[model samples]
Target: MKWASDSITAGQITLLRVLFGFLPVLGYALARRALSRHHARHLHHYFAMSLLATSVFYYAFAAGTALLPSGIAGALSGAIPLFTFVCALAFLRSEPVTLLRFLGVLIGFGGVLLIARPWETTHGVDPTGVLFMLLGAASVGASFVYARKFISPLGIAPAALTTYQIGLALLTLMVVTDLDGMTTLADDTRALVGVVIGLGILGTGVAYILYYFIVETLGAVTASSATYIPPVVALAIGWLLVGEPLQLRDGIAVLLILSGVAVLRVTPRSGAAVSPTPRWGPR
Candidate 1:
């Protein structure tokens, strides 16, 4: 993945961008096919547009990384759950925001500050890149809320949803990318293939499927808490795969974030109406 970070040429970066951008769409389709027999739904049209917006933000981040520090990028991303909570409140009023949830958001935000230590940045991160990433998070949060309010009610299979999302994303990528430039694939075929396949299928495809399932069961606001899980996974991967030094601060931050998520999860329902349990597939 860091190879993506290390990409030198514009072509390489674009390739990575398109591949990663198209990932979730592919994930959606694969997930849908695996989960149910129903045809894809009209809701997929909105999901596709959302996926495109997500791709723009993701690609912009990847392209602009040189303008921003890695620590800052990671730090800014931690705000996703907070954004999710805010979006839930403003848009999806069904999600109950209680005192405990507010406290949890504060604690999680504090953890992000501890982790990023943004004050230490010498060159400073790109403001625009940061904004784009935050916007991306907000968009995803909105998508989650929409899925809960609109998509889940129709009882469409998650697998079908997954398929439509990924397939549309893939089509979008195919249209945007110049096929002639794909010759770069021959230079570092193995690495390129690895990135495309891993990010495309697993990171984007499978991840969203699991995400949709979680959303279906947990409700969007609650399921959004899973945003807390990735940083820990990234930290572990960095330590194990790249031998990056694991600092004590990382451990402490992880604890605080997890604790906040737990607080949000276990607190009593705040008289918020719950969505009906999805029946999984077609009616």
Candidate 2:
């Protein structure tokens, strides 16, 4: 997506996302996997989840990053898990929303505030971009509930689930995408095209497999907590790689976010069992 985002128009990049992102899953979807009539009919649900989780999320994320600093954007993007927890409370009957988890989410959001400091800067961050980031976070957050409520119960393996999701996303993207812009890739240097391949296969495709499994194993809110990592990484990259200023607030924000995640891992007062059972066992 990073590579395609450079040369391809936003509309084109959205289309190429399906192309690059689906490459890793091309064979996996075709591999033998039993599909019930219900699973077949409900495929649209998975596609819809993917649409928001990946496609829409990508759109908002791209727009946000284009407008905001990397650290600020990453910090804001970490809200996905918080949104996931809220969605879980409202939607999933199984998501146990203990005081600790709720408080932790609050703490995390507080840290996000320190990291973002939206009040401190109105110069660089556009309201539209901030709205896009929030939308991306919300879409990703909702995706977790959608997966837990709709997809997990279907007794589908994560790999197979990801396979079908990506394959279907590809088909959906094709219908709306302009084919003419795809030829622009021919003019791109080999390195740029290779980056596109890497981003598609390694970043989007493989990551979805791990992400879906995590959602299956840990529940959406727990799995979504992994969102905390990117902000710290983005801060580091911005400082070391890009020479962006690393403020004291950034360090403090990182510590607070980590603490918030630790708070979530604390044992519940009831000490309820949290081990997850995947609906479909490995083939």
Candidate 3:
């Protein structure tokens, strides 16, 4: 996605992401006959999920990645798990909070401080970019909790949920996204392939199906732990592919953040066993 940022607008890329992503999901739903309409009561929940997880998250992350080094952007996104934990504690009545979990949250924020390096404002991170990344992270973080709380309990099939979320996102983007420079994406083969295959088909399409399955199986907080692995990958890609310089502090920060995830994972109270299994929703 970072590679494509220069050629395509963030909104256009996001629009294409869901546009392509929704195809397979819609196909799966049709094959399984899971295309039943959602209840009026749950309609709002689906909208909220789509807005948070798809619309806001895709655009914000794209914008942030465009402005900042992919490494820094990915590091900032490491906060997703922390924000998920916090949101779960607040919204999920069954979410247990152990001392180790609390400590993990602290450790994760410590890493965020290191990544931010607010004291080095002269050449420090861009505040706007950081804000965009955090907003994206928090939005998806909250979406995890929201799905677990409102959507999962209703037991919507993962394929159906994914279809609805991506489908709504695609429609929303179509309405608001400016198509002015969209054609330019085809001009750069690498960017075109990255946007279509990398971001669209795999990242948004297959990824969300797996994500929603995890959300249903393991609960929200645990499902969000999947995010912990991306920082290292992002840092490595930024250095090797983009030639972005990395410092010792960057490594340490990523270490602390992953360490936090490890701690949270080991905390018994934070285990997936604590998450209730999905129940079948109403017909």
TM-score per prediction, in order, is: 0.71, 0.82, 0.92
Q: Global CA lDDT of candidate 2, please?
A: 0.69
- Give lDDT tens digits, candidate 2, residues 1-283: 3334555655566556556777767556556453344567777887887687777776677667666666666667777877787787789776666788878778877876776567865545466666777889889889987887788777676767776777777777677766775677667776256545655677678778787777777777777777868877777777786676777876787777666766665658644434222343332
RMSD (Cα, Å) of model 3: 2.7
Candidate 2 TM-score over all chains jointly? 0.82
Please, what are the lDDT tens digits per residue for candidate 1 over residues 45-115? 54554464345545544544434444344444555656666767777756566787788777876765556
Q: Report the lDDT tens digits of candidate 3 across residue range 1-283.
A: 6877888888998998888888888898899887675454577788898999999999999998988899999988888988888898898876667888899889988998888877787765887888899899899999998988787777677888888888888889999999998898888999888888888889888898887778876777777888977889999889888899999999899989877866766647445434432433332
User: Which regions of candidate 1 fall more than 4 Å away from where they truly are?
Assistant: 8-49, 52-57, 60-78, 123-133, 176-182, 243-247, 268-283
Instruction: Point out the worst 10-residue segment of candidate 3 by lDDT.
Output: 274-283
| Residue 193 lDDT in candidate 2 | 61
Worst lDDT run of 10 residues, candidate 1, spans 274-283
Angstrom error at residue 112, model 2:
2.5
Give the TM-score (vs. native) of candidate 1.
0.71
* Ranking according to TM-score, highest score first: 3, 2, 1
Judging by lDDT against the true structure, name the best candidate.
3
